[model samples]
Target: MTPLRQRHLTTAILLTLSCTIAIAKTPVATGTGGAVATISEEASRAALTILNRGGNAVDAAVAAAATLGVTDPFSCGVGGGGFMVLYLAKDKRVITIDHRETAPMSFQPAVFLDNGKEMDFETVVASGMSVGVPGTVRGWHEALQRYGTMSFRDVLAPAIGVADKGFTVSENFTHLVDQNTAKFSRFPATAALYLRNGKAIRAGTLLRNPDLARTYQTLARGGVKAFYQGPLARAIVDAVNRPATAPGMTVRGGAMTLADLANYEARIRQPVHSTYRGYDLYGMPLPSSGGVAVFEALNILEGWDLKSLPRDRAEHLYLEASRLAFADRNAYLADPEYVDAPIAGLLSKGYAAQRRALVDETRAASGPVAAGDPYPFQQDASVPLRPAAVKLQQEGAHTTHLTVSDKDGNIVSYTFTIESWGGSGIVVPGHGFLLNNEMTDFDFTGPQPNVPEAGKRPRSSMAPTIALKDGKPAFSIGSPGGATIITTVLQTIVNYVDLGMRMDQAVDAPRLSERNGTATDIEPGFATGAQAGTLARYGQRWSDAPEEIGAANALVFNPDGTVTAVSEGHRHGIGSALVQKSAH
Candidate 1:
């Protein structure tokens, strides 16, 4: 059988198993007036445990996040980085916290460039210097201090127990290890933990990280400072500076200095704000183009009454909005600390009007069109990337997002990543986790746009988002795909409000993304093949393969009094559960 056909067979088997398992598990309580948390089952149970102990959503969120740090260590942990968007029901306030990692003050932009030329992907993607000052712990600690009702130590208990007693490695963890074995072999400490007897640990095997538990203990006793300035930091410095750590590339680890770790801090910033179709949308600020791009795409598509339009017209709207927003993303968006990112201008009606003018009623634009003025159009002129015209296929894997809402109406949506797999695979001994290779998130060489800069935040695709309808929190959504983060979140909201899909249907629905110039949908063999075919009738280039659609986890609250939640069926390791307000 052809490779595509073989994948279809594998997909069919997985889908059948998912359905069977979903049915076998008892349906959790769901609906109005109760709390709901959507995340991995292990994490969900931990949150529910907190709720049962009288913890609010903030408390439950802290619990779930800590549990994820232990069980899903490959994708996210205290060693990595993340961001959060929160909605408070009591006063009806929306707030965002930016805990994105920062480039160390000692970090040099030209460090990734060798002799004035951009380094190859291998050099840029893997190195100790590629590590950013981690911010996930500090970010979460600050959020809890300001908003949480439960003691921070109490929230961390579940994670400590899981780590100390050990937990089974999930299928997802196994896949990540397989994909990055080369990097794991380069770092002795990383290999010792993730690889057993010199081989990747098999799925379902119980894995323990005594070192990570020790790190968590330090934070629990001394706050986030312990990781940055205490023994943990010293141990990290020692491991990174060791002569054996760097691969035989042009660069080495002498760059990660002690002062860099001692001075690291995660910044807190205001969220990007906009109103779309009478609903308020709030998301991560600069360093994350998700907020502006999603808002722009939604605003552009708002002019069209998609509910009454045919499939083709709806698809046309999706493509046009993507093209405009993406052009803006590439040319202008960056760390506001480093660039004068025109957040206000990009989301302005004036900018939308200018972009709207470029959308033709029929036929795709012959080539990419740049968003004018603040974002001048640039013709891509490098070696022909096969899926030319559109943005490069952002590697699509290894991210996880969780959204939690409690009876008190406090809601939190958080997104996390270790970049790709075991990250750069250069673990600091005694730290027990991989550092993010987020340096690759920036352009290494350019006309100076999106290039790496010391202390500048790298652009991110994670878009943990929330919407307010009638002045009340209505939905929380996000996804796990390298660059498809914004598109997935935008599509989920559109599916819920525009298409009137329930949470499950919305998440399982087909998706399409366009940026720069190309448009892509879930491969034809995807469960939503019909949706892709229907979209193709408009303008998108639908691939017959099966890897293009993103995996989503989402939740929606209805005015009619129901809380609906869903996890993507195709996500081999994902599961969603809800504990509604009115559940018996």
Candidate 2:
């Protein structure tokens, strides 16, 4: 058999074994060699396969991310951008890679405006003008080149096979497509791939993307330059400049050029750091609101003896802390180079202590809370403070997260996105990939900090995080839920570190997200498992979450010298947790 057929056979065997193992394992895997956790079994398998082949954490993570692009395309892919937080075991330090998509030079403050008002999200989301310069491909290349053991070609092989041979369509995938059927039909390329004979493809049917497979091959052979400078880049620019919209559809085209695509570069940045009960938390820095926001929340929670509080009491505090942190997040966090975000002040314990004083364990704060001033805590005393007026809007809660580790102990926690599901509703004609609508993440109506501007990356809540104990990676955790991502990570960490829950329990525990909104959004199970009645006495208001709060994946380095991989059990369907060697 040919190499492609061999990979297909291998994948089939792996799928059968993975199903059997997953059925017995309960979305939790324990082993010694390595561990991988993700929202898709195929993605987990891809990363595990790499780990079994001696690829390090970076290599496995890149492989997992590439496979997620194929299996979880609506949420994240080569067309989008993301943040990767890595724990370098040998160096005993944490670092981050920021590849958040950038607005084109031609974009201006009024780009999303019409007749002096911000255009409706629906009116702009499906248009080419919403597409940002894609950074996923370059970002992947950068990680692999700098830290991975395998070449890009080698690492991409599994995803290419899956795309060529096809994987089974999932129920969640079908539902997401159903929601976007009308919007997707407006683009011929998008319609051709997602719809079968002009209708949504049913779950369990095999789906293939030969075009994407070929595109991956092109990148494998020509490297990142092929994606940024050659035919693929031209095709992307063409699609953005003048999309292949179906007849009767009308939308504005983008101003992105080959130069914009060519100039896109991923940055290696410092990870935001903090301490929670002696454990050090490291996460993506500026350009993402997740890291600092989560750090700030954790610092506030540090003042409470959550380990001694009742479930409702501790959870109420978590909700209040999140509210305060988001208040600051909306006001001060953005792309650091563009916005002089008081990063030092925001992460300072003094700032958190002052903010924490606003929390009342007995009564919840009312309304959208105002942002706090962190300028006093700034290390640079002479730096002026920006006004802390608050105005906020929600972002699409669709994205993907994955975690991976190798035998050498390096860990990677990554979160990636394309803004909304079925991003831009335009697949690159023949390239078989969607372009990111990340530009829509910009605050269309905002202060100077986060407003649309040339080369500015819109603020993100994609917090990929790692927690260290005694200068070693104790665990890695992350999730995908737009603004709720910070709360998800914070709650999970709190559940594990403070409440003494196992890794699986920490991830599966009921979640609550209060982004300084008027009412707290609760997962359906939030009340059932906790002291449900008394929470309202604390003046906690409730709004039912449309579905679940977050589908998170995590890895725990047990003191016993074993690694535990955990994923969601039911949210967005059962996620997959894979280990090279299963404990059972």
Candidate 3:
């Protein structure tokens, strides 16, 4: 949620009014056909290049995903991890893949604690303890092996070319590098790879990753094994376990071992899907609060007279729904393997009505709202909180997401992350990027329930979603903000379905979210200045002072069989939508 302080309201209001525009504050790409999609602009261009030459959606998606790995490396790449949701029209079915990172075998709970305290979040985030088993490779390869029509090598050729020739660094890359300059400087290898002669790489500068290119080559030949079981894995283990360059510190370095990578496997699982206003909404299951919370919010809002509310009132609804969803998330959401996530009870209309009754129309309810006793599926009767030893880092804008739907009616929405900015700033030798400090994404101390443990997945905010309206694909979208992803996406959907807006209008619409106990908005003009008093009245506390809530990219299908797409107005990620004339 937004981090606007009371004093900042004056600035937020001024910025919001001045920046509000008929056009999206960010660049958006729109097009049309029966098959519609929004992907990275560069990736979209590359995919279109492949499509015009006869590639299908799967082919285009592969190409787009690969290209994005190079251009949007800060958020995603071969080094990081993500999940993919594929809807294959030919089969008339949906498939979900869990390539999320795994905790290393050496990962133990006590390491992250500080004398029984958990304040060393900096150490957890920077040291080997924070790393998890990387999964992007396995996930991407599985999709290709199971359903893709094109050769893996062929699909990745464009990325290989870009990496080899060295594409000019985009503004987004430059900005992230500048933002995380300190973290990047902490490690010699990281400093050597990203920084140029001790200076940050600027936009338009040609950046090459010969090492990454080589890794990609290995993938082109060996598929997922190139990373999971080969030299790269060895390098990762060595890098994490090696001692820091600094003098004798009690903590040697990292704890990750080769066994972690060698034994790690990406699981193919069923998506946590539910029907929302006739649309089949499919999202990641456990470990991600996206699917369940999003469903809960939408289901609850469905009961309200949303259309009758004024714009701000609608915003209030967004805030309320967000609050309810986050409450459930903090209280019960977790890996299904570890805990029985109250998915059914949370999404049930009957249950939502009970929860909705607790919301005050005029102000936010103070403290957490009880989930109205318990539904049939909800079993554990308890309030959950991360102890003082546990610290929750606000969602980091350190990831990238893409949506690709092919002419064959195959749709894929993928979200990937390195956690935050180059992730721990520790690079493996011969690997272009650093390992993800995803362990920091989890609660590190305090309550035993929140402590890091072997085989438990950390909770994530990545929400790559697809909507099927009237039993057909309507829109596919997702974003890269921690808790805010759920809210931004919900708003976009409501704008189209309820507000009678066109594709562009719906996507470019202003956004608000209250997930994680705060109502937030990008003070329109400032894009970073946030206001929380409106939500504060509802009992949500403001903290972290949001710089950016979430960045969303979306695609909408026109009744005339056209398409419109948009990217976050405040940042620099390309968004594109395309339509095919026929199912060629």
Off by over 4 Å in 1: 1-29, 32-39, 243-251, 374-397, 517-524, 543-549, 560-562, 580-584
Tens-digit per-residue lDDT, 262-281, candidate 1: 66666667777888778888
User: Which 10 consecutive residues of model 2 have the lowest summed lDDT?
Assistant: 16-25
Off by over 4 Å in 3: 1-40, 243-252, 367-373, 377-393, 446-450, 518-544, 573-584
Candidate 2 CA-lDDT value:
0.86
Q: In lDDT terms, how accurate is model 1?
A: 0.69
The best candidate in terms of TM-score: 2
- Comparing 1 with 3 on TM-score, the higher-scoring candidate is 1
* Candidate 3 C-alpha lDDT tens digits along 1-584: 13343224323322332333333222444444323233355565556555654556666666777777776766667666787888888888787887888777766667676677765666566666677788887777788778776555656666666667677776767878887776666677777778876668988898887777677777766777778786888888887777243223333366677777777777787888877667888887777878888888888788877778765566567677777777777666666666656577787888777777777777665544443333453554655332222123444557767776665667778787878767766777666767787777666653434346786777777778888888787888887766667777777777876666765676666556655443344534433334344444445444444455556666665566655555655445445544444322
Q: Could you give the candidate ranking by lDDT, starting with the highest?
A: 2, 1, 3
* Model 2: per-residue Cα lDDT over 1-584, one tens digit each: 35575455445534543444333425788988799999998888888877876679999899899999999899999999999998888888888889999999998888888898989887788888899999898889889888887777767877888898899998999998999998789889999999887688899999999999999889877889999998999999999989898889877899998999999989999998888899888999999999999999999999989999988799899999999998889888888888788888888899999998998888899878888878888867575766666666658788999999989899999999987888888899999998888888888975557889999999999889998888777999999988888899999999998899998999887777888888877877666544556787788887755457778999999888889999998888888998877776
Task: Evaluate candidate 1 by giving its C-alpha RMSD to the native, one decimal.
Answer: 9.6
- Once fitted onto the true fold, the runs of candidate 2 whose alpha carbons sit more than 4 angstroms away are 1-26, 525-532
Per-candidate TM vs. native? 0.87, 0.95, 0.86
- If ranked by TM-score, best first, what sequence of candidates would result? 2, 1, 3
Question: Global lDDT of each model?
Answer: 0.69, 0.86, 0.66
Give the lowest summed-lDDT range of ten residues in model 3.
384-393
